[model samples]
Structures are given as C-alpha cells and as structure tokens.
Target chain A: MASGDREESKCCFKEWMTTQEEDLSELFQALTVEPENIDQLKQLAEKSITHFQDYIKRRNKLAHKDISAYFAPNWCSPWENSLLWVAGCRPSLFFRLVYALSGSEVESNLTEFLLGTKEGYLGEVMSSTQLLMINALQSKTISEEERLTMKLAALQEDIADQPIAMIAKGLSKVGEMNGEVEKVLDNHGRQMVKVLEEADGLRMNTLKELVKILSPLQAVDFLVASKKLHLCVHNWGRQRDQKLGRKEIDEEC
Target chain B: MASGDREESKCCFKEWMTTQEEDLSELFQALTVEPENIDQLKQLAEKSITHFQDYIKRRNKLAHKDISAYFAPNWCSPWENSLLWVAGCRPSLFFRLVYALSGSEVESNLTEFLLGTKEGYLGEVMSSTQLLMINALQSKTISEEERLTMKLAALQEDIADQPIAMIAKGLSKVGEMNGEVEKVLDNHGRQMVKVLEEADGLRMNTLKELVKILSPLQAVDFLVASKKLHLCVHNWGRQRDQKLGRKEIDEEC
Candidate 1:
C-alpha cells in the first residue's frame, strides 16, 4: 500500500475496466449471432446468471471460513489483510455483469433474483492462503512455526514464475526463528513487509484471464451497460413491489 | 464466522433492510410536501446524492491508509478482519437509498454519477484499531508489550459501555503476558472464538446506534425500493449510452 503501489493499482484498475468493456462488447456481439436464436440465448443467459449467483454464495462461505482462521495466532497474513477490501468487490461485480446481459427486464421474480444472490468474493482471490491458514490451525501434530515454514515452501512453488526469492527467504527465516527472536530483530522487523509481495502482479494476471473468459461475445459494451442494467432492473423490481404494497418482497432477504 | 453467528447477522441485516424501507417511505412522503416543490425536491435530492458520493470517496482514502498499516505486524486484529466484509456494504447501501428516492429518471448527468462513484467502506470500521496499531509501531519509547497493554486498557473503556468484562479481562491478561510462555495454548486456540465472542455483541451495538439515527424518518418502504432503484437507474444509464454508442461513458470509472 505504498503511494507508488496505490498509483499502480489505480492505473491497473482503469486498464481493467477498459479491457472488460471491450470483452463485454465482443460477448454481446456473439450472443446476437441469430435473432432467431433469442430463446436459446435467454436460456443460456439464465443458467449463467444462476451460476454467478452460486459463485457469490460460495464466496461468502469462504470469507466466513477465512475469518475463522484469522483468530488463530498465526493463520492470517498482512498481504491477505490488504487484499480483503478488493476481494469484497466480487459479488457486486458479478451481479453487475449478469444484470447487464439480462437486459432491462424488471419483474416480480427479479426481486427474488436479487435477494437470493448474496455474499462477496474476497474468498476467491485469497483462496490458497485461506486454505493453508485453516489447515495450519487445524493440524494437531505440527507446530505453528513448522506450519509457517511449510506455507513459505508452498508459496515458493505457487509463485515459481515470479521473482520473489527474497520474500520467500525472509519469511522462511522468520518461520525458523520461532519467536526466540532477540537474536536478529533488525532482520525480521523490516517496516511492514508484505508476505505476498507479488499479489498485485497476480491480480493483474487474473484480470487478464477473466477478460479472456469474457471475450468472444457481442458488442454490448459491459463497462457502462452492466451498471445501468443493474440500476434499471433493481428499480423496476422495487417499483413493482411498491405498486403491489407487498412488504413480503424484502422479507425473503 | 460460526453458523450461529451467521444466522444472527443475517437476521440483523434483514431487520436493517426493513428499517430502511420504512425510512424511505417516510422521506418520500415528506418530499411531496406540496407537490409544487418538485423542483426544489429534486435539487435537495441531488445534493444529498453528492454528499453520499463524498462519503464513499472518504472511505476509499481510509481503506488505503488502513491497508497500509496492515503490513505492520500485529497492527490488525481478528475482530477487525471479520468486520471488514460488512463495512464494505456501505457505499452500495448509500447509492441504493439515493436511487430509491430519485425515482426512475436516468439522465446523462446520472451516468457520470454512476461512473464517478467508486469504492467501499471497510476502513472506517477498523480505523480505531489501525490508528492504535500504527501508533504502536511508530512510537520510539513504548515497547510492543506496553502498546498492547495500552490497547487492552482502551478496549476495556470502550466495552465498559457494554457488559463484556470477561472478554476485556481475558484480552488484558493476554496483553500483559507479552509472549512469555507457550504452554497450555489449546484453551485459547478455538478456530472461530472471535466470531461468537466479540462479533455478535459488537455488531448488535452498532446496529442499535444506526437504528437510533434512522428512526425519525417516515416510512415509504425503502428496503426493496432502494436496491431496485439502484438497478433501474444503473441499467437505464447504460442502455442510454449503448443507444448513443458512447464508449467514453464508462471511461471515467
């Protein structure tokens, strides 16, 4: 979270939005392939929406599990803490994409759709760290230091392509110190070092992968389209419920 | 993070939605004071939306600062970690409220509003801890142990308003230990003890304060309305852009 890092992240985020727009436009074009295929397209879109909803719910589960691990002494890392805010954006982003493709159709059922889809996505981005943290907390035979040493080794394997040998070595030495740390306090206590030093690079890589997955569609232009679609459908559903004076619409949430 | 805590939090969220719905309805009734004041109402609403947008931006600054402190060891806490997810819902909640009041009007200026408002509110919830942690890290004279002891003392004062003496005492004792010995640690190593022990109680307190602030408004039922308005306005803007082939609409984000 250095000022330089912040500037880089902001630039990266803008670049991502630009890429998503292009990809979404392509997806929309592909979907419009045959106006005659509209029925099939709607069916497929509905299924995709449902999958997105499930994905959101799973992220909530993951957040809860990860937070559970955090209470255990050594389970949470500083990099993971920094990433939590960004990760929370996933659910809204997912909903935005789905709502965009679904068009401006707002109905009684849309309330159910919005209400049913709950949760966020911090869990997905930090999945590897969360799993390892949870396992370390649960393992009875291994000491916390041993667990950390293993975690560092595992990270080295995961980021083999990245140039993070220094980070790996720093963490490895810290793990080995095992709290008997009067010897090399200066070495271990550098100012706010991030354990996952390459997290931003990894996120940019993931964004690229996501764009690839979202490419090949028609030209709907998701950057603006999806957000507007979300607003329209949301308001439509609200007005419908208001027209009915149905208090129960919101009770389901 | 526990099943029971999740259930309780879910219920609390539902209650919040219901309360918001009631408040929105009241606000709408007040806005139609004479129907002749329609222009003035629109102006006031726009101002309110701008204020909400500023609030969201302030939260982003807070998050960046807090995340920076997260790199400093032991500065962040488990309770703070769990709260980060819930804190992030504030922006969407603010937008939903404004959009609910704004009706279905999707203007060109509104597109800018949608694109301009970006970021969430995780940092606000953990600001107190982040400040204390950063201060602890930077203080030249105070040992880490002394800083922790001071944190425990502050927590005792804060929770004195509640009835959590056991939690306060336990943490205070842990603070005093200063990493002394590592025996009999099983009692303190429950996977999600933080979730049930402090989270529910803390959230309930926060909810009570929020309700107090929101209680005076009249009831037009914003629970579903706000979310729907958000979606409707969002989609309306996007569709407008799509119609214009204005690819630059989303570039601002």
Candidate 2:
C-alpha cells in the first residue's frame, strides 16, 4: 500500500516536471536572440525576474511545508532538485544580463525593479541575518512579528532607531536561556555584540551605497518595494506558524 | 549488499559533515566580533575570501567528479544537499559583508579578491553561459581545450576578438547537426542566437561596469585573478573528462 502511494506521487511529480521543462524550453528559445535596445532588454529583465520570483515562492513554500508533504526528509528526488537548480539559474542569468545593461542612466530603474522582485536579494540578506542571530541564541522559534519588525527596522529608516534596542532585548533573552549558553555568550558575546552593532551600520551603509547609484525617487521606490516584500514574507510566515499551532493542538487532543 | 554500501557511504558523509559543521561554527564565532578598523576589516575580508575560495574549490571538485563518486544522481541525501547549500551561502554572505565594508578606496582590493575566489560569481556566469550553449548544441562531448579557450577568450582582452568567431563556428555546427534540429533552429534559433550573442555582450559590459568601481590596477588584478580561476576550473574539467573517457573505454573493453 505504501509503495503504491509512493508510485502515485511519483507520477504526479513527473507530470509537474514536464510542465516545468516546457516552461524552461520556452524561455531558452526566447533567449536565442539578445535584445537589441534598452526597451527590449528591460522587457527581458522583467520577464526573467517574474519567473525567478515564482520559483522563489515555490521554494519558500516547499521549505515551510509540513513533514508529510512532497519534500519530506530523504524524499526529495534528483529530478526535483535539478528542476530547482534550473529555476534558480534562469532568473539569475537574466538578472546578470539586466545588471550588465543598466548603464548609469537606467541604473536606478534596474535597482528598483530588482528590489521590487518578490523577496529580492536584500530581503534574503535580512532573513539570513535574523537566522544567524536565532541560531546563536539557540532558540526554537522566532515570531513572525519579530521577523517583520526586524526587517522593517533595517529597511525603513524612520524606524531604524528601534533595531538597536531590539537587538539588546534579543541578546538579554539569549543570556537567560541557560547557564551554559549564557556562559558561552559571556565568554564570546562581547565581540558578538560589537559585531551585531557594526552589522547594522554595515547594512545601512550598503543600502546607502546601493541607492547612491540611483536617483532619489528610484531610491525611494526601491525601499518601498523592499518593505512590501518583507511584509508579505512576514505574513506568510505567521499564517504558516498559526496553521502548525492548530495542527499541534489537534494532534495533542 | 546495495543497502550495506549505502550505509558505508552515509557513515563517510557523516564524518565529513562533522568537520564542515565545526569549520562553520568557528567561522561564526570569528564573525561574532566585528573588525575594529579598516585594516582589521581588510584582514577579515581577506580571510573570508580565502575560506570562500576553499569552499568553491570543494564545490567544483564535487561537481566534476564521476557519477560513481560521492554524489550520484537520485542518491543525494537531504543532509548532503543541505551541506551544499551551506557551502554556497557562507561564501555569498561573506562576500556581501566584504562588499559592504569596502569603501571606494578598498573596493579594488575586494573586487580582486572576489574574482580570485575559485569559481566565484563571474565564473558562475561564464560556466552557466557555456552550459547554455552546450545544451543548445545537444552534443555528446565538448573538449576541455575548447571550453578553456572559450573562457580565456572571454576573460582576456588581447584574445577577446576570437570568441565571436568561435561562437559563430559553434552555431554553424549546430545548424549542420540534422534536418529536424536545423528546422527547430530555423523556427526558434534566431532569437536564441541573438540571446547568446547579446549574452556575450552583456557579460563583457557587466565586467566593465564592475571593474569601473575599482582602481585601474585593481581592475587589472580582477581580470587576472578571474582568468586564473577560469583556467583552474577549465583544467579540472579536462582532467575529469579524461578520467571519465578512460573509464568508459575500460568498461567497453
């Protein structure tokens, strides 16, 4: 019975793989010729970014799914993995192409477009940073609101003032975790705190440097777009967390 | 017997995982403290780049290994995949950190270090582009020298004049492959050709734009370093290809 169920899932996966391959082939066929002008290039960039965004959404969905889903531990097929690689590579190649063509004049537009992409590289950085912090704390879970607040505090200058205090609070919580963890922090946390403080500065400087390449309005657009994606991811995380909580309650009952 | 072999491989992989995790933990501890000055930051950047380069080398080594080796398709355990992701992410995060702190003065040094990192982003782009071309041709084998010549041609200006002609020859060969293939090409190949041609242009322009941010000497260093890594990957590919070829002959005999 279990083997039969696995076979069914494999068949479905194969069907999905066919559709994805067609999409990829179509993209490759479209790329046979390069765009001759800026307008054409921009269109290509937009298309690529859109496709890339779709893949990211799928990737994130897979990542956060329950253990019983298609990608449970030790169950990811090579075909599925290769598809993910292709999805990732396609958009990246397009992005590099766009970046290459974005001369000084269109640099700002390109920057805005890049940031506006669903959970773009900047957002990835923010999430990764938060993950690093969470790992250091040896925490079990981070709240959706916490993640959103942290991202907002980093991206939105008006609220950037809150991050330091937040960091302090987070550090104190880590200190409270246990004696052993606290001792680890005490031995190394001073430098870690300094790094965290400096990391915020670095983040801000990086954003400023990136935006300096853009016009003022473009810079504003970039930030606005980034904020939107951050909120989106945050909301998604919260929904997932709530669903998991409900499941746990039912299981316990 | 097969299950026993799998168990043996899993054990070896577990040993590798422990060592890698320790390295990662040490890196995190090192990064816990922020560098105090520009000089300190430079040292950090240098050390991080070296480590990143090492990861890239390992990644490349795994990629070119024969199918019978550590990573067989469909045999990738989640643990192995996660390790690959970590290897990729660690270098990228460090590269971004270095980029963030590299003010205009040190930008060149950072850029050179980045390009020198074994199969870094630029190398990734080049390799992807080659893969695209190879896939398009649907050919069984590509010579190592052919691949190396193509990369060197892209990276070196004195020889940059030759790649276009080489690309043209490659396209013509694709055209001659078969009537059905030619028909497919005739139907969709024009755009694909343009994309590849424009891709090369984009690549050159991208390099120029990135190098523009560096000092002239640094720019030269960047190119030189990039060229060196390209050759390294190319040579590795050749050696791997030879091994595979010899194995095939041995099997046939």
For candidate 2, write residues B119-171 as lDDT tens digits. Answer: 12222122344435434332211132234223322222111122221222223
lDDT of 1: 0.29
Expressed as tens digits, the lDDT of each residue in A107-173 for candidate 2 is: 4345667776331122222234433532433221113223422332222121111222122222322
At residue A45, give the lDDT of candidate 2: 35
TM-score of each: 0.21, 0.23
Worst lDDT 10-window in candidate 2 chain B? B244-253
DockQ for each model = 0.03, 0.02
RMSD of 2: 23.5
How far in Å is the alpha carbon of A70 misplaced in model 1?
A: 18
User: How well does candidate 2 reproduce the true complex, by DockQ?
Assistant: 0.02
TM-score values for chain B across all models: 0.24, 0.29
The root-mean-square deviation over C-alpha atoms between each candidate and the true structure, in angstroms, is 27.3, 23.5
Q: Go through the candidates in order and give each one's C-alpha lDDT.
A: 0.29, 0.30
